[model samples]
Target: MTDTSPASALDQDPPRRGWPKVDKVWLALLAALLALAVLDRAQLGPSLLFTAQALWDILPFLVASVLIAAWTKATGLDRHVSRVTAGNPARAIGLAALFGALSPFCSCGVVPIIAALLAAGVPLAPVMAFWLASPLMDPQMFLLMLSTFGWPLTLAKTGAAIGLGLLGGAVTQGLVRRDLLGEVLRPGVAPTCCAAKRSLKPEPVAWRFWQAPQRRATFRASGLETGHFLLKWLALAFLVESLMLAWLPAESIGAWLGADAWWAVPLAALAGIPAYLNGYAAVPTVAGLIELGMTPAAGLAFMLAGGVTSIPAAMAVFALVRRRVFALYVGLGLGGALLASLGYLLWAGGGSAG
Candidate 1:
């Protein structure tokens, strides 16, 4: 016979007692700073400044995007995702690809928005399309690329962004159709903030969420949780990015990618997996590489590859999905980048040679 009393249950499952622990992300940030101080004291100040500046620059987008996700959850706007998912699959995928390419959200900033969508039962295909493209190109990036490179390269990158989104969406759709993509979200990840407590059926929208006490509470809790989650990861990501910039010179990237051999294009894409700084920072680097004899096609490959798989972007994706889904995300990014590069090469009439 089992002892089923409350006392027995309490004894069996004791509550933990201690001060709240710091998350690994915060510890990682601290560790990076300490290592910089010990090894290269001169870079310590610069690195700190760089992380601070980058965080500051992104804070507005972070706040706005987080609030949007929270609002959607609190007011039941997520029902609209069901409507979208119910539409024609091909049309939804195409629209999502185009919209993601034009959306202002950065790679990391779009995480919370997509989390809400997925948790609310949005189909994986269109979400994957947006996930692939949102990090690659935006209006600001397009203009910046135009100024740094010529119009041809800028247009090529924009095209790559949309094309990659389409390819990723189509692949994800096939996998989902075959019932291969099981349980995309990692267990217990963003359960509260992203509204992972999903309903079995769509709920009606309550546009004025503030009118109800429960809805107001949900809004506050969701926003706070999402904000905290984003801050820690982005802080660590920016710190790592700062370290990468300080250690890896643009000239080395140029040298590795400057070769005229056919292999250099794919090599550039692979190198970009780790070597990329960010879209804004990459423009001048690629331009310098071109001046240093890197072909236009290779530069395009490097930028397209890095745009999707940068450390910050990849980190965001890893935090949201299970390992298998994350693997797919990376594979799509690398493969799509290569294909886009080849297409641009063919269309540009031998690219640099022409």
Candidate 2:
């Protein structure tokens, strides 16, 4: 008989070599751009200072994410949330929207959780709702806005987020096909080995000397993970802030999205599609627009559309779900943004009339 042992397979040559013949020229291009960015500015001292300041500003959000993740893991909250989501689609959407409204997560930061939820058989509607709601509706952002922009803008933004989230959920449920969901429509099974290992592990003895070291080690590991996850985003936020501060022609942008135009809201929403800034970074930009005579309604619309709708998020959903369903999801976000913008305009107008 022919030998087909695992050892024989290990000894065989790989099918392809030299980085699998894939092109990584884009990586080189990015490296070149980074080199230019560093060299373009002579004040390395100031650059380092700015980077530190940016990191300090973002630290609270990063800390909050770590704490939330740890809490969820420790209290088995993730499991409970999974169970709720798996129980019923309608209830799942409500829970997800509420959770999204309350959680302190950026749109991009929430992607992994959303992916896990979808993988765990959470309905597409609720998953979509969470994705739309988490960035703008979170308590931190809401509270920050309340202080910075006052109660009116804060209330308007929060209402828009919740309304749009619910609308998006309904639209997604109405449009998506059951069969296209395939295996993703069912609840995920926990790994048997993980539970078994946890059961088998012995409880540690209470020793102060060892406890301090262990705690320190745990914190250090957590800090490293949080830094790794957030550093790039923090840098990107700084770059956007810098661009808005220095190069963007505010007068031109304002003229294009002027208050008198009927197309202003939709135009602003469409213009925001290419923008990658999250709510924290976007708040300052929107404030700048308001300073430039952009109406509060238009600014709110821009923030909503820009914060929730992103090319990357759309691409991730497309990769995971059916093409038709992906299209529906995109439509929900874009359409919901437009509808919310219109709703804001009508509500504001009605208030003025009254």
Candidate 3:
């Protein structure tokens, strides 16, 4: 044992982790977690359990996310979708919003799909439409909203998602037509959802994706890439959630976003940008806020804002896209949230619900 054979020692050494250490995203997440850990331990809150439970709860979504990633790669559906829909703005955007509503994906979960669309040269308007709508009330989130809130709020959010999609699509259409559209995303930040296609040109390969070895490899690669990206962000988001829920609490949200104030709606939207968890996870908090006298209008705005621009989702978008596009995204999301709040307020004022 004392005879140190250099080759044997090297062989016994643990395999080094290289790429994750270098990844800015990974480093940022670790930093955030470390800070949160210190804060939580100091406060003597249920910080450890809170973080653990948050991750535990997110497991199901993670599995679904991986599957979505793999399938997106396997099908080459984005290419097919782009071929059918790219040229038609109205129809494509309408379809995108519709698809978003139908799917179970959250904002983060939709990143791979978003990447695929962008990589395939899908028009920004419709893609933005999908992006806008996907986070609001997907079928699963819709059900949760219904159970947590009520039919009126649920319908309001869904309609708002569609309306927002239309708004984004129209705005983007104008931008595209005027040749005023900036780059959709920076070149390098394009999410690595699949193997980079060396060309922007659409090359037709043999039919039947399963039969293609390259396609399978792409599927595996995309799934792993997507999983890695989503996991880090999700962990950060949940840690932030645990901290805010423990410290800020839902009752305070109602106080800050009370219906009486003219500024409440906008403030609600803005507050949601940093503090919002995913749409489904938001149910309990929203419910608490409503019970604590938060207006339905303010609640609606918060939900919309948080869904679109929550930290993890926004981070994913920012990493994958350019600044101008990112600004537009935040703009649309905030504007849409405000519109939803105002509309809901007006409707509720007409005595629509309890």
Candidate 4:
């Protein structure tokens, strides 16, 4: 028979302690990337040189990411984000999407914010609105895409991110009204992670660049942490990009996914569900695909789908929310990706498919 008393539980065991700070999954990922590098090398010397070049190309973005993270935290814009989303339903949803587009945080990084909002009694719909749009684009991503895909496609992609936010919010509003949110938040419970540790109290944002010693410390910590988080994954992404550019033959993407295939857009969207690529890394790879005959529509679809639902981001959501909410999140990501792809096809017309 098992002991069932509270005193028995105390005598039975104490909670395990001294957990490692580093995530094992991340270590495993690094190992996998290293293995790929070794297995796929065309020649040891050439591959090392190419990898160095790829790392150099991505270094600037890493610096920018760190700066942005620290600056955003210092300005306390996130407190405003919380305030906006907790307002009137219609207005809240619109503003949430708009704010989300401009947010500097990545999909996984934003998880803490989303969790905090729920803990503070923010509505599921507007928070969900922000959640759906936040990962797809940031200012850094926008400029990069503009330089790579040109003004037309880049603008359309940005528009699509906002549109998805609006659509997701409205749909979620309907669900909210009917009390059909499917346990997006557990009553009076906060997610157990970085979010649980941070104080979510609303504080006045200091406009001065270096308002206080503590603020400076916060900015430095946030920047360092954000930079460290981004660099490792980005390096892995660039490595994959280099490998694809080298090993993937011309016409491979276009051979099956060209504009001629009526089903290609939707299929590409589906493929992006399980495919993992960081937003920054996806740009060069997508350009390479275009050069190699991948339909522009297909590449864009992959970017949309994969950006919103990358493996790490999706896993973070799953860890925080209930199974039903996770399913809804995935559903929205796929639907949003398809909608954007179809919109692009109409806008770009026949010229993009070749």
**TM-score: which candidate is best?**
1
lDDT of 2 at 254: 47
Query: What lDDT score is found at residue 12 in candidate 1?
Result: 53
RMSD of each: 5.4, 8.8, 8.2, 8.5
lDDT of 4 by residue, 104-207 (tens): 66665566566545544467888888998888888999999988988877887789889889998898888778877655753213322233224266457676
Q: Write the per-residue lDDT of candidate 2 for residues 1-354, one digit (tens) a residue.
A: 001123233555678755555323334434534764677554444444554675576566656555543333333343344445555667767776777878777655565455445433356778887878887778878877877777777788787777777877766776554444333321112212332243244233233322454434433443344344344444544443334334453345545675746788887777555554568777777777776667666777777776776653443344345556566666766777778777777777512211
TM-score of each: 0.87, 0.62, 0.75, 0.61
Ten-residue region with minimum lDDT total, candidate 3: 1-10
Residue 342 local lDDT, model 3: 90
Q: Which scores better on lDDT, 1 or 3?
A: 1
Tens digits of lDDT, candidate 1, 40-136? 9999998889878977988887787678767876777764666658679888889889999998776666776677667555788999899888878
Pairs of residues at least 3 apart in sequence or in different chains that clash in candidate 3:
none
lDDT of 2 at 307: 72
Q: Which candidate is the best by lDDT?
A: 1
Q: Look at candidate 1 and give me any clashing residue pairs.
A: none
Where model 4 places Cα greater than 4 Å from the true spot, the runs are 1-86, 186-256
Order of all candidates by lDDT, from best down to worst? 1, 3, 4, 2
